[model samples]
Target: MRYSLAIMAIALGIGGAQAQVSPPLQVQEIGSFHVGGRVVALGDMPKREIIPSPGAPPIQMDPNGEFQVEQMYAQYIKLAEPRARYPLLLWHGGGLTGVTWETTPDGRPGWQIYFLRQGHDVYVSDAMERGRSGWARFPEIFASEPVFRSIGEGWDLFRVGPQSGWNPKAAQRRAFADTRFPLAAWDAFARQSVPRWTTTDSQIQAAYNEYVQKVCPCVIIVHSQGGNFAFNAALAAPDKVRAVIAIEPSGTPSAGTDASPLRGVPHLVVWGDHFADSPFWQKIRNNVERWAGAIRDMGGTADIMDLPADGLRGNSHMMMMDTNSDEVAGRIQAWMARRGLMR
Candidate 1:
């Protein structure tokens, strides 16, 4: 999946004069892989394939709307010392591509590079919809005479037309009717999409399983939304996962909802104090503590760290890129090293 970091700056009107202009939105592409477009067959695996190396030339997404490839940008500088264990799978946060794992602007190594240098194989992927992922073909799919007519019929009924409010429950009925055709069309297209993106949790598990079969007993390092996905994936196949490091994961579903599929996996929950102040970061600490407690209660290890107040210069959520990134990475590397996950 290709994760993207979207930065939006809103300018609010002030008094009668021109509104103050905020900083421009700066989007940084994180994930390094893109799989969406044409369909290619990789025998039973479909069109998915791991790129030969991190430096491999970029590949285009297939026309079928999807493609899958893996990149290993950093390599272990030294051989693993005897008794070293599992490799690590590094997953970036939402709106970020895999590049988040690379070195920072100041040349200080990122987590992935640090781990790789310590003798661990590190992998990164781009989620669907961003980066080199295929484009949506809505116009073409809905362009046919019959399709256009069907869409028009629904549109007419929703608006003031001859068949306007054909049903007394027009508001609700129109919404369902109008959405049905497009939803179906997209569903059809998605089915035909190649190097398909994993829409369901099962697909994610399958992908993880495939990778694990080749690199058994791997540790998962997931940031933000990736943390949620990794937790569920680990629960689905605990044997393949050695441990998980979650950096500010999203909360589990509401009450009466299905519990997280974590299944007592060992996890390290890291959060920044900024989450306590920011509205968006609201509930982050609560959520992290909730999961941490659950993991510990289930006989798994769970640790929570608050980035020092001074360490958080800007948004706490951005500590991963802060001036103290190397320090943060060092702490993480020390943890992994203690676990025998790195040389």
Candidate 2:
């Protein structure tokens, strides 16, 4: 059954001080697990002496031990009366953790709760080297150093505002005139961005594929850099992945790759506004477009939801956290219903 906007509104009253979901959304179970990683033993590594913490005794650490690395972390909520046949896996973008689907920066319930109230079991994940999935020793287990995203880079690259409009002071920052992102919580959102590694895509992909094999016959909801992982996961196991919903995905499979395996899987590519302003996003969009076109050409159900063109305007790359996030999620829910994803 489809849920009403009232259910989502009930979730809006969720925050730190006010953590209540009226007529509380029922759930049978909530759990988490670590998936997909290999144990690597580093031989011929040097030993180092370092303090474990402030005012602590120095300990000699041997950097030549076997360690587990590159595993992904996932937490799930199984509704007592789920309305969907399969769980919904929420995958975050680069430099982000599963927190993307949790509470918003503005202190509102995020897509995790929204979809939960909509009657689907939800699984939120922290990709390898992110959040609960700890990082490994660089230049050993990992290929290179990690890259961090600065507030200004996020502000500009995320389309929250132009590069010239960003100011250290929140009051001085100028957002897109019609932006729906809550500017007051920009710093809070930045806190969610973690250090991301450019060279770990292969590891991340392997972990995500393992995750899919572990818990699927499910739909995948991906954002930004996760697009590549989601597409590859589905391609690797189309039988397990029922559908994919990508929001402002920054990358995709090579348009030349055979997409016939996904001809049976439904795909929804959602885009926000202001593509003309960023050449980088334009290139990304065109690439995804070509890939989606390829899927459709192979007799697959590949749909596009251009928010602005659909009359839902003022959205940015972080549309899931925008002021109108619930509305966007509602649109996605409606599409899922049309695709017969709901029970």
Task: Point out where model 2 deviates above 4 Å.
Answer: 1-21, 49-59
TM value for model 1 = 0.54
Per-residue alpha-carbon lDDT of candidate 2 for residues 119-145, written as tens digits (9 for 90 to 100): 999999999999998888898778899
Candidate 1, poorest ten consecutive residues by summed lDDT? 1-10
- For model 1, the stretches where C-alpha displacement exceeds 4 angstroms are 1-84, 105-107, 128-214, 253-264, 309-315, 340-343
Q: Write one digit per residue (lDDT tens) for candidate 1, span 1-343.
A: 1111111223232333233232222222222332222342332223534555699965643345433332112222223342237767776654445555665433444666556555565665543332233223323321222111232232222121223423433243332221212222222222221232233333333444454455557788777756666766676667788778877676443323233444445677666543323444565557667767766666667766565453533323434544455566667777777765654
Global fold similarity of model 2 (TM-score): 0.92
TM-score per candidate, in order? Answer: 0.54, 0.92
Best by lDDT: 2
Model 2 weakest lDDT span, ten residues long: 13-22
